[model samples]
Target: MKQTMTNLKQLIRAGRGIVPAHTVIVNGNLVNVMTSEIYKADVAIYEDTIVAVGEVKDYIGEDTKVIDADNKYLVPGLIDGHIHSECSKLSITSFAKAVVPCGTTSMISDLDEYISVSGLEGLNEIFEEVKASPLKVFWGAPYKTPYTFPQSTVSYNFTKEVHENVQKWPECFGVWETVREAVTEEDENTLGAIVEASKNRLPVFGCAPMARGKELNGYLCSGVRLDHESYDHEEVVEKMRKGMHMLIRESSVTHFLKENIRAVTEVNPYLARRVSFCTDDVTATDVLEKGHLDNLVRLAIKEGVEPMTAIQMATINSAEAYRIDHLVGSISPGRIADILFVDDINTFNVEKVITNGKLVAENGRLSYELRAPKRSSVLTSQLKCKKTTKEDFEYKVDIKDGKAKVLSMNVKGPFVRKRRDVVLDVKDGIVQPDINKDVLMVSVLERFGRNGNKSLAFCSGWKLKKGAMASSAAPDDNNIIVMGADAEDMSIAVNHLIENGGGQVVVADGKVMEFLPLPVGGIASDLEPAEIARLENIINKAANELGCELPEPLMYMFFLPITAIPDYAITDVGPVDCIALDTFDPILELMEN
Candidate 1:
């Protein structure tokens, strides 16, 4: 059957829109975020798309279902241009069920989390599940991934031995190296992958620090078009000047750069049109604890952005950046019948939400069908860590008698530093850190099962109880990471995690107190948003009880391997000195010199 909208059928169709179903939204001020215009009108829907929007006297018909807006605001559907569908901490269907109630009608995801644990087939399966949702979810490929990113744990490709991997490489013409060199950009595969996406006439996203002037230009020269990693105003100006649409991001790893955005807004008001809002990665708890794209809209308004302008950034700017403005960014005919009922632009709140000409949420409560997605590749992907030796987690350091100096990177969320050194105590082969001294060991194990790929480095933060504490952002289906105090509790956590397949867990006193079983890609769950939040509290309290303080325990868990931002990030490869833009050999070397 032809797509109800041509696009949906060609991609992932969830049935179709029932046409000519009479529905009148009367007595509302419709704000067209695209043209930055607002007018009093009564909108009419004839199926899944809006038929007309103006005065209702001209839209009268028998058997029409009239919704008295009671003079509420009717704007276009809120669309998040870039997101990690995995961030919902729910399966596609469960995710859709949660966000639909928040006035989020459509979302575009990088699918990085799924791909990291599954593969292309896994991504395709997710697309199929997202297809069956009430909200619209579009798929975009990721630009950069952690060393853990390639999904080798599932079906990743980096070898010339694999026919499928080799087939995808001839598509490359220039240097498109790994995400490792966002500065030098030496990999040709990156360009080839993006060009392949462009060849398919799809909007692909680019990932780079955007601080390297020449590298930024080269990335644009490749097929990648949009960028969501502008960390500074200087970078944003350069990108906009070079005609790149910048996605102002507030991810779990990076929040909106306050001074940077403020400075940009002060200098050039016109640049606002080129800027859009995106949440790269967030947990399900943050969804309830904070909000979705709505948070970005609120922040922009508070940061001196005109409320209408903020709406334009999140709605029109986003749609236009990805070339979908005509479809969901504004109140127009032939567009999906998605609208947000807001009482005020400032201090935005979801009063009601209508999607596909149907009311699914009223005052943040679900009013329609929302269920778990049918998963096709849940635990099918696995990496045999049978090769991982216990020695892989152990390291030896020579102590020069009385005192020893060790190198470390203080963990302050996602940002890393290149600071040369610090001092520590050396005992029992491992260099022990003084907890009162505020120093600790941070490590990233190659759960990809590669021998000698484990990275161990020192970082400051996490004051655990009487045991050892650890956390892993490992995106492997078999990835079971334990975070807690003491060896016995850690063992208990690991056993519990293995029992549950794989997911994030927190342990204490030899018991599996709490865990979020992510059997699906080992990144997200098939649970409700509220359920994720409830279990997440156990983690937060565990952190607090042990004195592991930062902010949100799980919310702050995103920084272990973010290479783009400046943080002493450790990966399966090693401790990356980001500011220096190089890997530290035996991390202690940095501290000694």
Candidate 2:
């Protein structure tokens, strides 16, 4: 209360010109997001809050720091409406360094993957890192863990008690994604979390991809008002018409923005008022080479969206979605002084970034040093599985030396999978993978050292002709998932991850070709973004050398274990028909155990 009163008094004095402002930006064309206007103006910042936005020569005293923008466009700092920092495989501090220079000042993250591995006890460790960094992190308390019931294994389940505790934390602003499948099925945890978020007056983010009519209605009745999983422009228009705040996602592998933005460019331009942008799950390689939300703005503008609307989508629209518009999303009085100077609105090239009234980055580089956090002991010891062997990944069949017909999970893409029936040669009671048929062996092993559970299934879309790829950064469960044509290479990949605590690895002919160490919680690395990107490029290169044609193979494989999406998924339990929400036998014929 005392701090608020003092701040109010200081703001009054600064605005009235009785006291000098800490910083002043002159001769700038301010991109007013709230009013959708760009006009020549000067901004006055008192401490870290904007005090005035018009002619501010009176506020420029002897101690005031003056910056000559020279008629550059002054825009608000970019905001990522939805992101998973853990998906970048970079620690909190490292992730900040990657995006802050790209003019990103804020990010709303659920941190669901990290919580699934470290549990609620490790929340404070992440918060400690968030405090020491320049980026502002808005956390969303996830509704549940594992993403599906009986489909995957996770160390911690998001109970009502956990939700109750996290909702009271200052960093937690709202409920994270409410899975459409879970809500429509009346999952107790999800429904109860929504109720608690409403009681606290917090927004409920949603996830409903490819839903329509009755299914979408049923999910919306649960009070989820925001969605980020629209697959096309029609889906985006349908959700926007139903009063859903749509977030057009353009991640490293998923390129939905080109199609989804058509909802505003071609269909209804007014619907963009409720639209925002997010990079749901991106890699370090994408962030280092391509700009963060700034890239999205450029794409939106090129797609025929007005420049102001594109900037608004990257800024104010997201802040309004989370009800934090009063604190950010615009360069208005009483808001934090996070402003960006760009010479070209069409290209969206960032020249200078002023966050909290301090110049932190310029010309795509951070001027000030960003120190990374020390590795925490709590997150470094997450991988606890035993060393795997060739026998662990075997898909045994009843036939002694004949061909066997089995059900295989065929990847249509990264998000959709279908059950494919294929015939494979049976050699000595083992169903051998057919490299000619593009049928490869895929398995998920429980890595928590609790159950040591392991399951096997066949996959075909990977197209790995000779080698194997494995990763512990799989979504929701964060378990070890390996896919390969040869069992020996599969074993080598899994054991390599186990030996290094956790990470992504590719092995060919029983030799590790590339590895990216995720020593923190077996999901994130403490290294800088450049180093992470270097390892990711080499890993993709190794996968390409092994005959995999998919772009971002490691990223595509990471989503295979998540049962929240549609069609089918494979976990440590077995192959699951996600639509039916049940496990199915891989063998088509009934066989004796």
Candidate 3:
């Protein structure tokens, strides 16, 4: 309270010109996101707060540093409504280094991966690291961990007590993405976490992907107010009409902005108010090759959206949705001095960036020195599972000398899989993946040593002619997920990850093709963003050369164990029918010998 009053006094004094501002930007067109207008103005900053935004000649002093904007457009720094910093495969500090220069001033994360891997203590270690970054990071205490109860294994679980304990932290903005099934079923832990967040006066973020009608209503009744998983424009419109804030996501694999933004461009322009932007899960290569939220804003403008509306979606709308508009989201007085100088609104080319009244990035590169904090030992890889063998991945059938019918998973796209029944010839009671049918064997191993549990299933759609790809960075649970046309290569890929702590590896002809070690928590790396991007590019290319055709194949395989999406998914719990929550035997029937 004392600091607030003192800061208010300083801002008032600086606005009056009695106390000179620390920094001043002269001759720039201010894009007023709140009013949807653009006008020429000068901005005066008192330390880290904007004190004035109109004519500020009087606020200039000999010691005040003045920046000539050269008649460029000044817009509020961008904000990502929802993102998983871990998906970038970089430390939080390194993630900031990649995004802060792209004009992303703030981000909100669920920290689900960190919590599942290292628990409450690891979450705090991440918070301590955030302090060293120029980017502002907010947290949402996850309602549950291991994503699915008893189905997926993890190092820690987000119980009711864990939710209550994390809610006491000032950094926790709300409960994060309560599982759709949990909310629909009125699960006690999910409801309890929501109640605790409500008691603290915080909003609950949602993860109801493809939810409609009564199910969506039930989720809303549980107090989930935000969503980033709307599949299309109709879903966005329905959720918006239901009073839920929709975050249009443009991730590496899942692209919904081009289709979802139509709720504003075609359906009802008024719905734009409830719309914002998020990067839910992005790779460092995407951030380096393309921009972050700024890229989304540009794509929206090109998709028939008004430039001002798109900018608003990336800034004020997200800030207001997260209840942090007063702190950021605008270039108005009394807000944090996070601003971007752009050449045009149509192209959204950010020429310079100022965060906290300091010049940080210029010409697409960070201009200031940034050093990430040392990682705690708790963040290292927790993979305690033994090396896998080829026999472990063998698909066994009761029939010894005949063809067997099996229910295999056929991946349709990035997130959807369908159960496909395929008849394969069996030899010695063992069925091998049929390369002629483009079917490959997939397996998930419990890497936490909680159980040396390993589940095997056959999958199609990777189109791998030979060899294998594997990683210990599997999502929802950081176990080991591997897929291959050859059992020997699959064994090599999985063993390589085990011997090197944890990483993504490609194997062909019994030789290691490419490997990217995720030494930090087995889900993130401590390397520079460019280096990570380089390794990811090479690894994906290696998988392509081995005959896998999907873009970002390693990333797609990483989510095979995630049970949140749709149709079919496989975890260490064996093959799961995602829609029905039922586990079934891979072998459907055996032919007469």
Candidate 4:
């Protein structure tokens, strides 16, 4: 909050006096966003704050500066409720250059790709950049296990080290998206970290799906300040009733845009203002093609939402929820000069944008700032696999006798679906792939630490490729991903990953087709978003080479180990029941022998 206050004071003084002050804006609809009203005025500005805003001359002096705004419409600068800076496939600097021109002046970003650890010095570097930049960036601490989980048990992934650092540093606006299974009294590391945040008055975020009564209160008591995972509209109201801030999400994973707009304003009426909007995960490619906040704002309007209400969801409501309300959410005198000029208020299409009092974009075209990227320290990652062979992925499920029941685990939705214990006949001790059921082999390997921890299981969903469809998803490229029609193809996939050191790879019928060498954290590319997306497309084709028809290969690529959001999933050790948090029968129908 000090950040907001300091910036506010700087703006106040900067507009106080001088050569017509620095600059002036004249003759436009000065959007009095403070009350959702708009009025015509000859606006005057000095530096980054409005000095005088009224008809003709309300407070203008002799040496007033001005920019002709004859027939233009002005509104408060936009704020994205939540997004990831890393997901844009760019450094903070690069991402800013790209989006600023698109009129996104501020964002609450949760970059899980960057791990906060023992030193936390590196993480602080990024935080400092966020504070000092032209585009305001709000940070959220990562709740994801940086290099653990989905491999076997939740052990070795998250540790007390993260808790200790957060207890001391508290580098983010708050903790983001915590799972119940990831926390416990025995392992109160993250739990304690939340307590520390609460003591320090920092917000702790949570995701309690369909939770009620005790479960809901339990989550709030644990320090979760807000919830973005409330899917049902009733649950959204329930959370608000419980005094927890409700984050209405609209994204690829969950679509709740129109629903929330109706629920808050139409259905509940009283708690309308407590709700907000967010797109949890948007890739860099989508950032370029569809637009950032443009997509959501347009969707709301198209879906019959009031223009003012939609803007509030993206701007004012977000600011208040993050507790930075005093700094932004309006075009008042002391607020930062992040304003948007749109042609039409109802349609809400932006024609010009001013961020920090400088022109960032005009029309739909981005006035991109192609400069050197802001660098952060301590980014070290690689893919490691030794002597990978087709035989490594091959297994005989037959136990002594020709026929024995098998175990299968599966999840249905989210990234972590459900676990099942089904037994199937195993011939020659090897459980064969069930092409009819969309069940395929899956595995998760240790990437960062040198434990060589490899867990294996069977999953359903990929409609077969004759060979292995494999990828090493370390974002740091520290481990290999190998899955295929047979052990022979699986080995082929692993061998290619082994050769690349770290990246995504696919092998079919003994032929290497697609590979992405993400040697740095396996999640990011040193290259630009376009380049990475092009390779990602090739990887998509390779998934089709294995005869699968999914929207994006990476979605499936990510599903291999997500343990919370229920889905039929396979890990390095075995199939995981996300709800149960345990291994199940491979087939998940017949009893395990």
lDDT of 3 by residue, 467-558 (tens): 99998887888788999998999999999988988889999999999999998888898788999999999999999998888988988888
Q: Which tens-of-lDDT digit does each residue in 242-345 have in candidate 1?
A: 88787888865577646456635787888888788877666676677567777778888888889898888878788888777766788876678888898888
**Candidate 3 RMSD to the real structure:** 1.7
Per-residue lDDT of 58 in model 2: 95
| Cα RMSDs, all models | 5.2, 1.8, 1.7, 4.3
What do the candidate models score in CA lDDT, each in turn?
0.61, 0.88, 0.88, 0.61
The weakest ten consecutive residues by lDDT in model 2 span 584-593
Residue-wise lDDT of candidate 4 within 149-231, one digit each (tens)? 33343212434456545544544677666655555322365676666667667777676667777777766677676777665
Model 4 segments more than 4 A misplaced? 1-11, 18-20, 41-70, 85-94, 116-125, 128-135, 143-171, 180-187, 372-377, 384-387, 396-416, 419-428, 474-482, 567-574, 583-593
lDDT of 2 at 524: 90
Which ten contiguous residues of candidate 1 have the minimum total lDDT?
169-178
Candidate 2 is scored at a TM of 0.97
Q: List the candidate 2 regions with Cα displacement exceeding 4 Å.
A: 1-3, 590-593
Candidate 3 clashes between residue pairs 3 or more apart in a chain or in different chains:
none
Residues 246-274, model 2: lDDT tens digits: 99999988889999999998898999889
TM-score of decoy 3: 0.97
